[model samples]
Target: MTQALPSLKDHCRTTVAELIRICQDRAVRSALRPLLAGIPDMQIRAMRYLPRNAPVNQDLLYLIAGLVAEYPCSLPEPNNVMSFGASLYKLSQHPDIKATGIERRLESLLQLELDSLMQPLHSLVVQFSSTQSSKTSIVIDYATLLYHLRCWDDSRKWVQLTWARDFWCPKEDGKEQNSDETLDIVKS
Candidate 1:
């Protein structure tokens, strides 16, 4: 009989921890200082304590990319959004990971998880379009995420939807209050 391997979450935790340890050397820090200078110290500390069994998300992916980018070791490709997406696409094509068994592809699982997270925002957009409430903030937040993710088409769709319904304006004391900071951000 063969022993079962650890879960993907466990594997990811171990891999990240090992990578962090490798980058802890003085020489490595000096080299990485320029690139990592913009990242907060709190976030760096939090990386050390990432829960081993927790589900992955975009934030975790960003942190992992940041850490991987700073490593001096050679990788098949640079640690950037394109390379990350390519790696995920490659993983999605694997036979075992693609098999409809107990274990699914990591990319597929992550995509499903992300879609679930976005569902609430989609619902909020639909509801606010009809009701014109303060919940328009959710649509703004969703648009911002899309912008950062480089989904320009979807981001524009949300911005257009919000503008079409004039949801950016809030009625205050019988006056149309139109001081939405997010509107400025989304427009640019």
Candidate 2:
């Protein structure tokens, strides 16, 4: 009998946790500085620690690591609650975020193709961080994002559809829809 390979999601979760741990040390955190520049450079230092077997390519992983590092505050893996799309939705709904402004940004995000996703996505995440109230820290589910980036080329385009659903779907009973359920719906 052969052993099952680790799922990409699991790999991503471990990778993210390790990055956060390594960043806890000031020197190690400083090494990730290449990721902070407006445009990502191929020489990002954190690439050494990220798993090479991830479904997403090294460049995408580096971009994700940069985004995650932006939030130096506590990084807790929530129960599939705060995905990139869901977090954007929450940010769009924040009283401080003007509806027209956020709506335009969300539109641009939803329209991106895989080749064009990185920069715009980075900008949107930075926008979310800046526009959000100080009382609440930024939250983005990097593990799921890794999986989505890998699946960006799916014929059904489920990843983009899921993000659109999360952003545009009407809230039911003042509650956000479960992100997994939203994805399943997009898949079907």
Candidate 3:
């Protein structure tokens, strides 16, 4: 069985010869086919090798890596998903990237948006005083929450949350200033 195995040089030569023959097939224009067929055989065979483990010259490896992975692509950035960044970007951009677990993020953004819509929420940075039996009350900023829900493309809920319209950003120096926080929305 080992004796039947062809030498690397012989295999390389045979591959080049076959490729040259295929490229020169009569169906194609004779003048152009021969010129295009002139590519180095070594390069063609390299495709077969590099693709396995990114196995050099391996067609399967290269082609497989070139494809898109769907579901996981919808996940947000900086979480550092995917073996390659470019591939991850391409995956996210795929048309099939539907609303998966993004609803939870939507919920989070909605809460934030509601907080933002309300009056520049008291940050309690400059503490004044605490009352007797100082109860720690937490206010859910529903208005800002609605804004995030709106931004999340839950436009159907727009009518439901429409009656609730308010947006306020805190300011220093008594001047209008853009809020420092923003939720970057990505369409899934």
Candidate 4:
């Protein structure tokens, strides 16, 4: 029989080290120095590969949660943030991990995103409404994000607005789609 492959832990560690090296490159560091300033060196080193590692290990999840708590403003790039969130979402759905630890960090990250938006509900509504073309999916996403953030009043307002728009606006096929299911999900 052939020798077994390296353990996942060892593979992850090597991947993380290579990722750290990329982050530490002179040109990369020069470009990212300002963004990295407030974050602790150790946290930055771990966070550079968090999107890759967080899905595979609980320890990495905890480390990332701690780093986010310490440096709420030091958000990763949008793509990385999306990947991180997706990983956490997957982990949170696992029966073994559900409600044990990952849920809390996922909630914290959702709150962090809401806090980062930094605009009141009225402003967000106005901003999205004033655009020449409104994307229903984006409106729904914002409403869902607010719901997850526990901004009940704001979320309700958005759901109502979105429902009204869906009802009143002419559909491409001249038929109105019921948005009650979407509204119910947000209300919950």
Candidate 5:
């Protein structure tokens, strides 16, 4: 028989110290259901990249930071770069996040992720969209993601979410390359 899990309250405790480690696994422990954990790594890391750390609107910065400092996106090394950016784009809009910290870091990460992942995503979108859509289908558009990020003018925020894919891209010198991409949390 399997043992029971921990409580949700026991999981999410906002602290920069834990951000680095929890980033490896957004969902450390869950009871029987879903629970909010830590800040998305991409957003936190993104905060590191902002050219201008100036607060967008004082109150909002802290709020966003608190949220960023709290979200938990445990994506793997490479693919996570994009996943975190996207997660932040959504989270920046949250009222709590806006009241907390710098949105620029999140913005910068988003931009960076998109810049690197776009062409590949573009091709993927083209190929996938061409196929038939099932009753339940999820579509992530890499194009204009920055535009979407900028739209965090109201209540929105990125949270600890995870996604996976098998994306293929060309080598820097134009050679075709494909890898079995897993977005981090692999259910072993």
Candidate 6:
């Protein structure tokens, strides 16, 4: 009998818990600080938490791990419903946020190709962390971030569309409003 592989959500949940543990340990966090600087070659410290030769995008995984290490947060949402997009939406609505700044940043991020995504994304995640730090602890869905990164290269750019919807279509009465319109606008 063969063992079944865990789903991405399950894998991410486990990975996130490991990342939180790293964040809590000063020594480990210090060792992994290089990852926050986008050190591509010095991956030995990060290698232990990563899968061994899995048929997955290692670059994206490393990027996510680095981001999580840099901005430590507890995963308050359930793994299945955790959403980077939703967090961005909440950030956009933050009272301290400058709406136009976030709008422009998100627009630029959506236009970037996979190769150019890391730096801008790092900046935005940092911004998200800073903006929320004073009022509430920073929270982000690492699983959703990884999933979106993997899907970023799809021809239709569905991940981008979904992000735009999450940002623009605020929920009302326990449902999303004008999400279809937001998606259509994103498609053009």
- Clash counts for the predictions, in order: 0, 0, 24, 0, 32, 0
How high is the lDDT of residue 25 in model 1?
65
Model 6, range 64-120, lDDT digits (tens) per residue?
767776677776655234345566676766787777887888888888898788788
- Lowest summed lDDT across 10 adjacent residues in model 1 is found at 76-85
Q: CA RMSD for every model? A: 21.2, 3.4, 26.2, 19.0, 17.8, 4.7
Candidate 1, 87-155: lDDT as tens digits: 223322344333232123322323333334333323222332333233311112211222323322353
lDDT (0 to 1) per candidate: 0.34, 0.65, 0.25, 0.34, 0.29, 0.66
What ranges in model 3 sit over 4 Å off? 1-4, 26-188
User: Global CA lDDT of candidate 4, please?
Assistant: 0.34
Evaluate model 1: give its TM-score: 0.23
CA lDDT of 38 in candidate 4? 32
Off by over 4 Å in 1: 1-62, 65-83, 99-188
The window of 10 residues in a row where model 2 has the poorest summed lDDT is 170-179
Query: Which ranges in model 4 have alpha carbons more than 4 Å from their true place?
Result: 1-82, 113-188
For residue 86, give model 1's deviation from the true position in Å: 2.5
lDDT of 2 by residue, 39-128 (tens): 444344456755556556766767676666655444444453444666677777677777677677768876777777767777777776
lDDT of 5 at 35: 14
Descending-lDDT candidate ranking? 6, 2, 4, 1, 5, 3
* lDDT of model 6, residue 131: 71
Residue 42 lDDT, candidate 1, scale 0-100: 43
Q: Clashing residue pairs in candidate 2, if any?
A: none
Q: How far is candidate 6 from the true structure (C-alpha RMSD, Å)?
A: 4.7
